[model samples]
Target: MMLQDIDAVIFDLDGSLVDSMWIWEQIDIEYLGRFGIALPDNLQYEIEGKSFSETAHFFKERFQISDPLQKIKDDWNEMAWNKYSYEVPLKNGADSFLAYCKANDIKLGIATSNSRELVMNVAAVHGLEHYFDCIMTGCDVEKGKPAPDIYLAVADALKVDPSRCLVFEDIIPGILAGKAAGMKVCAVEDAYSEAIRAEKKELADYYIKDYTDFSSLY
Candidate 1:
């Protein structure tokens, strides 16, 4: 009955479904290092929930870098592609959880702030592309997490009512986004968001430390 009450499930890709958040941190270090700019201590937390385009703009403005916004995104994508394609692994129990959703006939969607090319690459490499009925990137929407645009778009793509959707997210902004879209959100635990775990729990409708924990939902 619980499963029946939810028509669709949406997941965030990075920290929520895969263990690739560290890659971005390292990339930031290296990218800024190229300009002899040391990354700010609070930069990661500040930009944790921003869309790909927004993050690129932030880097250009904050660092006073000469690169165009698109160029910054392209360079970061280039640096990240190989790692996402080969090194990133699924979060604990993600495989089984996705299988469960598919077997249960739950409409599955992915709404991510990552680049479309990289998202497809990672999904294909992990064999997750088949599980998603709809996979939308930040570029597909006008705004990103905390703005509700991406999640709303995914819900539309899946042809599901936002009120009947269940979202799994790792960051506070993402949790806020799902809630703003009128969906119930489960905050997934990720080491990248450790500092804000308590905050996430407060913001989400439910809190799950791992995908296996969803066993109770059945």
Candidate 2:
């Protein structure tokens, strides 16, 4: 892929750009224990790029969990949200990569499965909010990643063709979403999540270990 043909690069936050992915594991261990159900290691990767509500809904069905999982999410959100202030680390080279995009006139934006408030907080906390021309959250669309709705919405907001947009994702669902939206997709290894480096074969158009002169693929 060549960067020259790309007009915008949309990113998936959480594991892809921020260190918050680990917080989810913590939340899983602590909360699921309250219900006495061991966290299902198999579901984490499948569930990335899902909205909090969607996740709650999933748990409801999967574990026969009671309804109004909203309260559980609210509690988890409270924990993870605060962590963004001092704990969430930006993925290595992420800041510099965004700077490079800005310098090169590449429009950047976030299309995340997280709530708008959560995404905004992470971006603001890391001083990454300024780089995004648009930030579309799962709440803004009927479907989250793997559905293409969010990415299409992002492309519309960026005023760029979906095919001209390149996506960077750390999870398979996010990559499927980008690809379904008709864009080129690139994968990033997320050390903290189940998206194992070895399993990256299915998630990325190009698997990148780190951002190093990496923007040339447009």
Cα RMSD to the true fold for all candidates: 1.5, 2.7
Candidate 1 global lDDT: 0.89
Q: Candidate 1: deviation at residue 28, Å? A: 0.3
Candidate 2, residues 1-218, lDDT tens digits: the string is 44669999998888788867777778778778878999887777667778767887887788887747777677677767778778988877888888988988999989888766778888888888689999988878888778999899999999999999998888877888998999998887777645366656565677776675464532
In candidate 1, what are the lDDT values of residues 38-66, reduced to their tens digit?
88899987886788998898888888999
Give me the candidate number with maximum lDDT.
Answer: 1
The positional error of residue 2 in candidate 1, measured at the CA in angstroms, is: 5.8
Task: List per-prediction Cα lDDT, in the order shown.
Answer: 0.89, 0.81
Clashing pairs in 1: none
Off by over 4 Å in 2: 64-69, 193-199, 213-218
